[model samples]
Every structure is written in structure tokens, then in C-alpha cells.
Target: MSVYQGRFEGRCAIVTGGASGLGKAAAARIVAEGGKVVLWDLNADALAAAKAETGATDVVALDVSDQAAVAAAAKASEAALGKVDILICSAGITGATAPVHEYPLDSWKRVVDINLNGLFYCCREVVPLLLANGYGRIVNVASVAGKEGNPNASAYSATKAGVIGLTKSLGKELAEKGVIANALTPATFESPILAQLPKSQVDYMRSKIPMGRLGEISESAAMVCFMASEECSFTTASTFDTSGGRTTF
Candidate 1:
């Protein structure tokens, strides 16, 4: 039996960026544990593919940076899946790899919009539904860069750092309300997003990590699954690091 055996048997979960990478892995695990999943992604093709692959009926194409779109997506998810018992905010972008002063303003804004604002929109819209049901679990995907800022990636690092702060604040606010919120900081992972970075940047990232290798999607998914389960009831407003010894704090 799975750790989430009967925990989320009939429950519903929402996973942003679920079309691929960490989000898709989490959605797959949720379904394997007997939970229904509503996958939200900006990529329609990827969304369709993920739906077909996971056999998940609930899929939505919407930019998480758009607050109104996020609201609509959440409503649609509730209508499709009944109620959202778990939420995994994982949508993000690598942004431009350049010095802070040399970084393009547009690129920086876009990264922050997707990584930080997108998360805020999802949490803001989903929390109400959870509060109404009197139960909820949230796992926000952050990064090791958030804890220790990475050079040449100011936008990505800053936005992830903001996610950490937001998770902490929300966790505390809902601590007594039966809704738990937490953040996961994973080091460099072998994700599709990594392809966006240049080889030099990738090398720099790997060199800094003590693990000497990128993390696996399944490894990150396991941590997310645990956090979204009822077994993680007591912990809230905390950062769970899965950096393969790279995270020292």
C-alpha cells in the first residue's frame, strides 16, 4: 500500500506546471495514490500530452501569472474534481543568465511574474476553497537558489526567495485553520527547463553543488508527495531541502 493509501482516496489535487518536469511527476504520484488531479499549464500541447499520459481528465491551459485566469482555472478545477485537497505550485522559468546589471528588464519581470506572482495567484485562489472545506495541503516548489542566491541568475533566485517568504507567511496565517503550507527547495534537477540554460551556466550550477550531479524528477516528486499528504500534518511554514548535501544551513 502507498503511504497515501487511503489518505486521498477520493480527494482532488491541483498541480501547476503539471505538463512536465516536477509538476507532472507530482501529479502522476497523486493519481497513483488514488487522488484525482487537475493539471494547469501554459502549454496546451504539453497539457494534452500529460493528460493522455496520466489518464487525467482534468487539464487546463492558463498562464499562472494572470490572476483572473488562475481564478477561472481554480473554479473549473473544483467543478471538475469536486474539491481541491492538495495544491502543488511548481510553475517557474529560468529567466536570463546574465549579471544583474546586464540582465534585460523584460526578462527579469517575466521570471518574477511566472515564478513568484504565479504562485501567489494560485495560493490566493486555492486557499479559500481549502478553508471552506476545513482541510488543505500545499507544497510550493522553490529552489536552492532561493536560500543562497546564485550568481548570474538574479531573477530566478529572487523570485524563488520570494516564494519562500510567501510560503512562510501563509503557513503561519493558516496554521490554526487546518491548512498547512510549505516550500520545497531542490537543487539543480534534470528537468526540461534546464535545457533553456546555456552549457556554461549549467556547468556552473553543477559545480557549486556538492552532489556533483543534478537531482532526479522522481526524487523531488517524493518529497512533494509526502508534503501534500495528511502524514505531513504537523509541519507548516517550513523549507524542506532536497539539495543532496548542497544545502548547508
Candidate 2:
């Protein structure tokens, strides 16, 4: 990938799930463009690896599902970075795949807690910081499954749908402010997260994509960088598609 020397210069970004997958890709992109980034994830080992790989400005190991932890991290971020200009909520999990009737209650709640509530915590804690600075960009990672539900993955689908909805509402609320909110609905991608889904389900998702292949992390990161940049001005509460033709709307 070519370097983007100054697109994000003078900016500080916070990327949840920065230890791996799409979040790591986004963090790497921002750092490549001369931006400072704080990596937040539950895995300390992966966080260390990402810091080594991406040269992120800082790393914090915490579960975003905990509102108190999120608040603390937000405070720490302000102390270290002085201000936050970008937020990428990429931390999530693919909960167990089963029909709604057969889905385990525990699994269902776990998915909602981590995927939906966790994102809310991050946004709630960070948006105020952004408002204080009078400038910010928020990129929430939804999924094509959110737009068009996939059979047998009710919990995962529902939480992702909620993410898209939340982005829209938050964007509208912050419309007049410099901070903007947007969502990205990507199809299946080549990432460790893919291992969580059933083989049959993974194959089924890929087959539905016109491209006939999983998306590359670079593709998602590229679009996210643009959305997290100043060029994304005037486009808030919008859902951007990176579904390889799998998403019609």
C-alpha cells in the first residue's frame, strides 16, 4: 500500500479492537498517514504485537463492554493525547450460529453485550471528548448481514443492525457539530474473525458475493481512512457499502 503521508497529520485516533483484523488495518492506515493512534483491545499480547507492527502511539487493554472501563480509558486518552479526532468502533464477535429458537440464551446476551453495548460505551465515552475539541469523525463497523439478515445467525445479525441504527441516530444528533458519524457494511473478509463462523455459513456468504471471494482488509481500511478523513465532510449518518455487490441498498 502506498503511504498517505499527511492526510491525517496532527490528528489523534482511537481504534477499538486494534489488536486484530479490520481494526488493526484501520490503525495501521492512520499511523501510515502521520496520525497518532491509541489501540484498545482485550488481548494484551495482540496489543503489543499491533504496537510493534503499526507503531501505534499507545495501547490499552480493556473490554469495551464495561462502561466504567470505557470511561477510564476515555479519561486516560485525553490525558495522553490531549484530544481525540477520530473513533473507529471495530471490536466485535460472531456469536454462535443457531436458529433463534435454538440459540442459547447466554450466547445471545453475550453477543448483544459485546457487539452492541460495547460499541455504545465507546461512543458515549468518546463523543464528549470529540465535542470538547470541536472536531471528530466516527466510523462504526456494521455488516452486510445487518442490512440483510443471514439465516441461523440471529444474535449477530440483530446487534449489527443495531449498530447501523445507532450510527444514524448519533449522526443526526451531532449533525450541526463538527463530529460526524457513519457506518460501514462490509461482506465477509479474510480475517481471524472468520474462524468463528461455521464453514458452511462462511461458504454460503462468499457464494453470495458477486466477486466470489472474501474481501481484503486493505479494501475496508482504504474506505475507512477516507471516511475518517476531512474529505468525509458533509456525509454523516450514511452507510457505506463494501460488500462486493452483496448489498443492494
Name the top lDDT candidate: 2
Q: Please give, for residues 1-249, the per-residue lDDT of candidate 1 as tens digits.
A: 134565568778999999999999888888888899999999999999999877675899999999999999999999999888899999999999999989999999999999999999999999999999999999999999999999999999999999999999999999999999999999998999998899999898888788798888989998999999988989999999889888887
lDDT of model 1 at position 198: 96
* Global Cα lDDT for candidate 1: 0.92
What candidate 2 gets wrong by more than 4 Å, as runs, is none
**Looking at candidate 2, what is the lDDT of residue 44?**
96
- How does each model score on TM-score? 0.97, 0.98
lDDT of each: 0.92, 0.93
- How many pairs collide in each candidate, listed in order? 0, 0
lDDT (10s digit) by residue, model 2, range 1-249: 666789999999999999999999999989999999999999999999999899898899999989999999988877777789999999999999899899999999998998999999999999999999899999999999999998989999999999999999999999898999999999999998988988999998999999999999999989999999999999999899999999989
TM-score winner:
2
Clash pairs (backbone) in predicted model 2: none
